[model samples]
Target: MPYSRHLGPLTPPAWHRPWFRYIDAVPGAEGAPPAPDPAQSAQTPPADPPAEPVDYKAKYEEAIGHSRQWEQRAKDNKAKADKFDAAEQEKLSEIEKANLRIADAEKASAAVAAELLQLKAANANGITKDERALLTGTTEDELKAQVAAILKLRAPSTASAQDAGITGGGSAAPTSRAKTLAEAVAARINKK
Candidate 1:
């Protein structure tokens, strides 16, 4: 009788719902497929979430490729920077050397001037005779020779306009050969 609560033993699960209850109650209907037992499905648990797909080969290759590129670029940049730094250091060294040369020349010129002044002061008649004589030394003659040599070394070359007869600060167009030779000889003596 309990099973007869339905029109028959075989009925669709959908027909057992309230919305479809009218279908079962229809007067001359035979029956439908039997509903599945709920206990059969209850014993099993729900499935786990789907796993993410992996591409190990692709990921490994990409990581290695990027690392190599980074290492190469790092080496290249370091080499370039070192090259420029070395060049810069060389340039700085050259400039320092030039500056040292200029400083030495200036100091030499100043010392020559100071020695000339001392010689002049020593020879001055205004000083006491005893103090003036006490200033006697080879310093005055030696400094005079050095100054003359420096002046001769710094003089204009033989090819200057003065020697080329080019007018304006130059020798006259008609200057005698003897005059030129005399000038050269005089420069040589002064330089010695």
Candidate 2:
């Protein structure tokens, strides 16, 4: 026995009901032929056609499954792209840090070289620890010039006397010699 929706006895599909006409149901469809007149339809009626059952639910399910598979592929591709971007960013940061370290090392190296040059210059010029700060210049010629200036300013102090022996341009009369420091002081006051 065949399954039937109604509780009554099974009836043949041909005797069940008349099939609806698609063209007559929806009017004014674009590029469709005009609906036939009732008089003309009666004179030449369409022949009866058997209806075939269609699995619409199965078709809808198949479409949904296909769509899900594509969505999953898209998500996987996005994940791979995100991972690639993250790795690239990390590499770039490490390279940037390395560059900064190189720059710092270069700065330190330059400072040491300059300090060594200054030490060499000070030692060659016989500059003392106290006078080391007085020296200044980046090149050999400039350093030598500074050294010459320093030496000129630091010349022996004995070259000049604190008090003059003679003050006037004219010859003076001979004076008597004092025997003691007290006598010399008394003589200077008396002369004045």
- The model with the greatest lDDT is 2
**Clashing residue pairs in candidate 2, if any?**
none
Off by over 4 Å in 1: 1-49, 95-192
| Model 2 agreement with the true structure over 42-146: per-residue lDDT tens digits | 998469777789999999999999999999999999999999988876877777979989999999998787667768988987878886775555556656765
lDDT tens readout by residue for model 1, 120-172: 75454234444333332235554344344333434555565555556556454
Candidate 2 wrongly placed segments (more than 4 Å): 1-92, 157-192
Model 1, residue 184: what's the lDDT? 45
Report, for every candidate in turn, its global Cα lDDT versus the true structure.
0.60, 0.64
Candidate 1 lowest-lDDT run of ten: 129-138
Q: Evaluate model 1: give its lDDT.
A: 0.60
